[model samples]
Target: MTGNRTHLLLYAVEDLRKPLIQQLLAYPQINYSFADTPSELLFQIAQQPPLLIFCRTTERSRVPTSTPLIILCPTHEYHPAQFIHEPAIVDIVAETDLMRLPFIVLRELREEHAIVRETHRLRTLVEHTPYGVIEVEIDSRQIRWSNKAMHHLFGYSAGEMQNLHIEDLHPNDIHTTIINAFQQMSSGDETPLIHITCLHQDRSTFFAILHRAELTGTGKRSSSSFLPMLLVNTKVSAPCKSMPTGSNSPCARLIKDCTISISAVVGQL
Candidate 1:
């Protein structure tokens, strides 16, 4: 989805910078857009931010919040800190180092493009997969992420399911068993596929195969404190009738519990 536009922006004079423009054109990664005047440059900055910028420093110019700005100026006349302090300008180069512009721009943009690409890939997988996939906080079991299948399966809209919990959908009779299962999963045990009855948003119950894996701190949560895991549940059959209170039916035996790890689901992401 992100490959529709070019990545580079330059604000400079067209006629005088012929030699410099040729050097920039040599790199195939560069998708260059030009803005000759201060007003045009400012408009581009506000409307379409680029990976990198090469322009003459003017009183009207303000660097973008994140895009790397490389000012064109005489080395001796430049005050490096003034532009660097703006929180956007990344470098300043004199005319002598014009050859380095493309390399520096490509290096600056590589990481940004990779992150965008990966995020798009993951979003596509989650939305298209048949199972109801969710990521919940290990300690709270609060739902952090849920795909379309999850919301549809539980009879909740995307907005309604935000900040909801797994317990919110579990039948009250199975609460104690589910809690114990979560405790075991959090302690680092691999849980097998367990069949269970879960409550929908309308208070109806359905049978689903729940799979759990313990995700350590990495990928989505790159902190020591936040250990969120994946929960993948596939609806195996139609909605089942809720059994009478304290009845030992065939459904009771199917009510096992589950948990998961974020790093383990990289392919899913």
Candidate 2:
């Protein structure tokens, strides 16, 4: 599920300037300002840092981390590699609807959640459990599930978390990175995913990850997918990989590498 619009900050060549600005402003949620040069783009991206960015095809970058870059190119500019590659880039090469952009932005945040009416036993188990549990929807901004531990771990009350957009938990400074991840998920460059972070209630930061699930549940509401878990580190990077990849344990599978203490991992001899 996408957003009404992802707030944007633009960096484009002088040629496509006017029309692109006009079209973007029409969507109320999609806020933006301009950066005529890539250098200017980085400065604005860091300062006012937006959800996504749009630039021309002829543009190049020294920006290391990937951000969603909408390529505005001339008719003849469609090269095979350019159009088909990792990190999907949208084009103004042809006339079309950009309705997909907002939707994709909304989807990327892992913000969608619809409260699932669970059996009493299941609901009780979720609440009483010690692990920080989270039930989220992958397609909408709605946060439909969580336990006390989940809310406690982050700085949000159950009501606050429910009302705010999932992206609120993430620092706005890195929103461009988030939007990039969202676009990748939208374009098949990535799969259902989660990463680790820690967040405090007064709005502090910590380690947590998007809960991992391999199946799609029956969507009771729209296209949103039910996500049932989001694990966080009580301690940062006890090596974020809690278990080694390809491990036999289900818990280990969710985590990349199993790391116990020097004594505990190997057993005290």
Candidate 3:
């Protein structure tokens, strides 16, 4: 991991004013970069953020950033709750703690690196998977994630389904069935792949092979939502042939007028 040298950013008006800057540079494993002004510091952080930032608190306003920050101030002025409570603000330190700073920086850096590695690995796995994986909130029916295949089969572009409720994708006749399946799964039932009529963005419909799996380890993020589940859908196929398209059936007329205007009032999409 040390093959790529760790970058440490120090932002202060004067380099000689902070002895810790020179002290940190003495460590061969870390490379140092300096930003003389707040704007310069923000630019560097945005372009290529360092492993840790030791910023001398400035009078100029700063925006919330994802980079881990160590706000340097006098011990009397330091307030952990008020200053370091934000997600990006990792810790507040006084000048007196200069000798112990390197160890704290190293520990936080290692932890952050590990998290990035794991997230990247999971993202790679999700993107390349053969099946279209989807995560949804049971109560709100909000979609959390959808892979490329899901978008293609549903006739939606990337992120189009994010704010859409899962119920909107299904015909009205199957809403009860879908909800029942989730309810059964919540009651500890082993879910099997079921066929359902799913609507495409073009208002066309196809039968989808759907498999629901409860997300047990989702933790508190979805706990209040009652249940969180993963819906894996395979390739879209022809609609069910169970419905007869004979001349006497209403569906036959609906199919004839399919290109004109298809309505869900008669039957499932």
Identify the candidate with maximal lDDT: 1
Q: Which ten residues in a row have the lowest lDDT in candidate 1?
A: 253-262
- Model 3 is weakest, by summed lDDT over 10 consecutive residues, at 259-268
Measured with C-alpha atoms, the lDDT of residue 153 in candidate 3 is: 70
lDDT of 3 at 109: 64
Model 3 scores a C-alpha lDDT of: 0.60
Residue-level error in angstroms, candidate 2, position 118: 16
lDDT tens digits, residue span 1-269, model 2:
12533355566655656666566555555556677776787787667555566655556353324566555454465454656754545334332444444444444333322223223434565565445655555576446776787776775778877775455566777556654554454333423233444446676677554433222223222233655544544455433465433336444443433122211322322
- Model 2's alpha-carbon lDDT is 0.50
Superposing every Cα of model 1 onto the true structure, what RMSD results?
A: 10.1
What tens-digit string does per-residue lDDT give for candidate 3 at 13-132? Answer: 364346776567556565667777778877887787687776766622363375677777777877667773466777777766676667677778677676576546544555454445
Task: Tell me the lDDT of candidate 1.
Answer: 0.62
Model 3 residue runs over 4 Å out of place are 1-6, 13-18, 124-131, 134-206, 209-230, 234-269
C-alpha RMSD in Å of predicted model 3 compared with the true structure: 13.6
TM-score of each: 0.51, 0.38, 0.51
Clashes of each: 8, 22, 0
Residue 95 miss distance in model 3 (angstroms): 0.7
Better of 2 and 3 by TM-score: 3
